[model samples]
Target chain A: MMKIVTRNLITYATLLLAYTLLFRFGLSSLLTAEKWIWVKVIAVIYGAMIFVTAWMTGRRDGKENFLFDAGFRWNLTTGIVWGLVSEGWFLLGLHSNYESIRMIHIPLLIWSGFLVLHFSLFLILKRRTIGGVHKTDIFE
Target chain B: MTTNDTFHEDLLGAWEETYKKGQLTLWIFLSLKEGPKYVTQLQESIALFSKGTIRAEEQSLYRTLRKFYHLKMVDFSSGKGHKGPDRKYYHLTPLGQSLLQSFVERNILLFFEEPLKDLLLS
Candidate 1:
């Protein structure tokens, strides 16, 4: 658990640093001309990173037990972080009167949908009592 | 290498892999049978008891413990760590002890029989 948490903290920190560099250096200007294409690309990349990290963490632990739960938790954490960051960016754009930044909502909406699905699958699997050590549970 | 040597190597490797995988659960139970242990202690005990034959990873041990906890085969209490936060010290429940006892009687003790002992030695 500490290992996973530490790994995730490092990942999130790296991600934040990378995003800051991209935006502060030149990505913000590029976003205007590209009509939020960079934003979409970044969103996709972030989603993939979150998924791969969670999946790897689960596989390392024991997929039969921790896979979906890991994915769910990762998704939940990243989803909130993504939502907050995007909302902040959008609010900043509004204050500065940048029309193109409003499109950030597209990725946020899509991510929220996937997050809901991930959460629902987690709940379903827990209710069904599938996977984990219960796979061979005789007491049940 | 000769074809025969290669084949033998592969076969032995596969057998060892399967054997280790199967024995992990038993070793885990035996480790807990000694006393309640945290994950690191459990890993150390298993390696020591198995004479370095089995070395379980932290994640795998946590996964097994989580399963046991869910199954009510094990219970844990929070205890202070050496320099870190609290740790969960897991101990076998009554059900787990009974199961281990029954398992030893039905399966493990068979190897101690005269014929099986000779076969194993041979």
Candidate 2:
């Protein structure tokens, strides 16, 4: 259990690092004085990163490895779904009337929390499914 | 016969048929004693060791392996086959070894001796 949690934490950390680098170096410099074009570029990079990670993580040879827990399709699909939802929510926040700098951070924070929550949930559910079979007392 | 002996007899009677669902686990464990084996190897070994009296269909064998994998009694790892795509190898765990040992010590196969003796004497 500890091993699974640690591995997943590593995956999350890697994801965060990737996004930070994407925005900090790639998006920030490219988007200067032109927000939409840079956002599109960053979106494309993010999409490509999702595809690459999914492919790497889903490799058949890595099935027994620690990193292959939730599987490629699960990770990529959930991420894409959540990303779209977050984008919509961010847009909603922008269009809303009571907008402030403090409120602006809320949607992004919630989206980040959703990522952690989704990853953790997937791990727990998988562990439970595997662990549940041992309850049959086959050893006894 | 004593109650335990009768129960043993009954169990052996049930295990006599090679296609029975119950004996598949024992057969799988017996086949794995040497080391890790691929699915095809396991299938061939079971049939050969049983003198062609026992055989497992590919689907059933795959399902059994999946269950054993979940139960942690076996480890499934990929290995290159001499020909074709990579084959999944099944290795018995220590837990599996001990459990199979317990089954052997039970002398379940002893029930076959009477029939064997009759055949030899005749």
Candidate 2, residues A19-99, lDDT tens digits: the string is 644544454345444566766778687767766664654453233232334453345444555445445444654223322
Candidate 1 C-alpha lDDT tens digits along B4-113:
99999999989988777667778889999999999999999999998998989998788778777777888999999999999999999998899899989999999999
Model 2, position A16: C-alpha lDDT score? 46
Off by over 4 Å in 1: A1-27, A32-70, A94-102, A127-140, B1-6, B34-91, B102-122
Per-residue lDDT tens digits for candidate 1, residues A61-84, read 444433335256656666566556
CA-lDDT, candidates in order: 0.70, 0.62
Q: How displaced is residue A99 in candidate 1, in Å?
A: 3.6
lDDT of 2 by residue, B7-122 (tens): 99888877775335467788889899877999889999989887876788876677667667766788878999898999999989998898888878675655457886677678
For model 1, the local distance difference test gives 0.70
Every candidate's fraction of true contacts kept comes to: 0.00, 0.11
Error of 2 at B9 (Å): 40
Question: Which candidate has the top score in lDDT?
Answer: 1
TM-scores, each model vs. reference: 0.58, 0.40
